[model samples]
Target: MNSRTKSINELILTAKRDGRSVKYVSDGYHTFDELYYHRMILFSVICHANKDRAWKSWLHDDGTIFNDTFIVGIQTDEGQYTYHYKTEYWDMFQVQEVPRAPKYDGHKPKDITRLLTL
Candidate 1:
């Protein structure tokens, strides 16, 4: 197994033990202190990709395997936002592009569509 796969596996195990839902934030807008949330997001993203193979070959040839860290934040009832961590530098992290779900040419069949159709 490769480093990325190993890391992902370890993360998956951690998430299973903690019992938290995973989310993916490509914008790198989260803080490091929210390690649990971050790990959860990463796991979700990887699992969505369906590349859960244990070998390194599962990753893309470019060597990039979903680059973004997870962070925690809370939205206030008054419409304000708060981060879990305080820092002087916020621009250091760059936003990443998440994979888009395959689009259907027209209305999708109910059996295959995971999303609800209007």
Candidate 2:
């Protein structure tokens, strides 16, 4: 099948209909299981990868698809906006738990401004 023909929403819906796993990746991404186990919010889909951007799935109650990549406030009814699914739609973004820095064990040495001191 031509993966490039499908959009992110199409891919997701197809997976849902066929009971298949949706393929996704990120700059620092783990498997779906890892995301689930780590407790993350699977929300909206976008074409761009912005570190500070977080999108939540917003579908129309009347079954309408809107291709808006630059959504204000990341509201609902925002379906897949990217044109190519093969290359662009694969990177899935979500809000996951970032690893915390190692706690300081009363070590009065080195730079205190450093976030991680292990």
Candidate 3:
């Protein structure tokens, strides 16, 4: 399939629907949704390398709290918004630096581990 034709949301949804294991990368983006007066927002879909679980992070510019996930990191104009999936639940944070991923175990594919580190 031509990945170039799909949006981040589409790619993630497709992967989930097909039961295919794949990761994603994007050069920061914004999407418009009518739910909040067509506000533009940023998000990321995190795929765990060795598990069937995935986490989604929604970066809220207005600091609106979404009760669904636990909050972490710093919420400020200068902080980076991050989301982490832990023990069956998702957590959100605004960080100065992206959280370090789990260390490589030498079992999963290199492509998956390459983007993750201790």
Candidate 4:
């Protein structure tokens, strides 16, 4: 198995032993309802390499596939956003710094919205 896979496996073992909940968010504004212990393990492996960001594995609820890697980016009012899957894959387990989305008129959209919404 490749190093990525191996590291994921090891992470899985550790998470299972620790019993921590694993959370994953996608760019499309979707979040995992609840992640399995093993899945959290895989996430930990990815996080280890990408400390500045969060990582996730896209797997069927039944745990059939776990090859896809998702990296966390900026969080918004909607929810946490992730980098494109292709980008994450091409980086070879490297975490890409999520560019701070351009600010609008010296304030972020969320900041503006927060003021208005509240």
Which 10 consecutive positions of candidate 2 have the poorest summed lDDT? 78-87
The estimated TM-scores of all candidates read: 0.20, 0.23, 0.22, 0.21
Task: Give lDDT tens digits, candidate 1, residues 1-118.
Answer: 9998798778867876898544441226654446645654543344334322111111232443333422222112222111211222222222232242122233223332222111
Model 2 lDDT per residue over 23-112, tens place: 453225686556643432222222123324333233232333255421111211322121111223223444221232122233232432
Candidate 4 lowest-lDDT run of ten:
98-107
Q: Could you report the Cα RMSD, in angstroms, for every candidate shown?
A: 19.0, 18.4, 15.6, 17.2
Q: State which candidate, 2 or 3, has the greater lDDT.
A: 3
The residue-by-residue lDDT of candidate 4 on 1-118, one tens digit each, is 9998798767766876898643453224544433333444453454454455443333322433335543333333433433324324434444444333222233333452332221
Candidate 1 wrong stretches, greater than 4 Å: 25-118
How well does candidate 2 match the true structure, expressed as C-alpha RMSD? 18.4
Clashes of each: 3, 4, 2, 2
List the global CA lDDT of all models: 0.33, 0.33, 0.33, 0.41
lDDT of 4 at 108: 37
lDDT of 3 by residue, 53-84 (tens): 22233333344445553322212232222332
* Model 1 residue 11 lDDT score: 83
Give the poorly placed runs of model 2, Cα more than 4 Å off.
Answer: 1-6, 23-28, 40-118
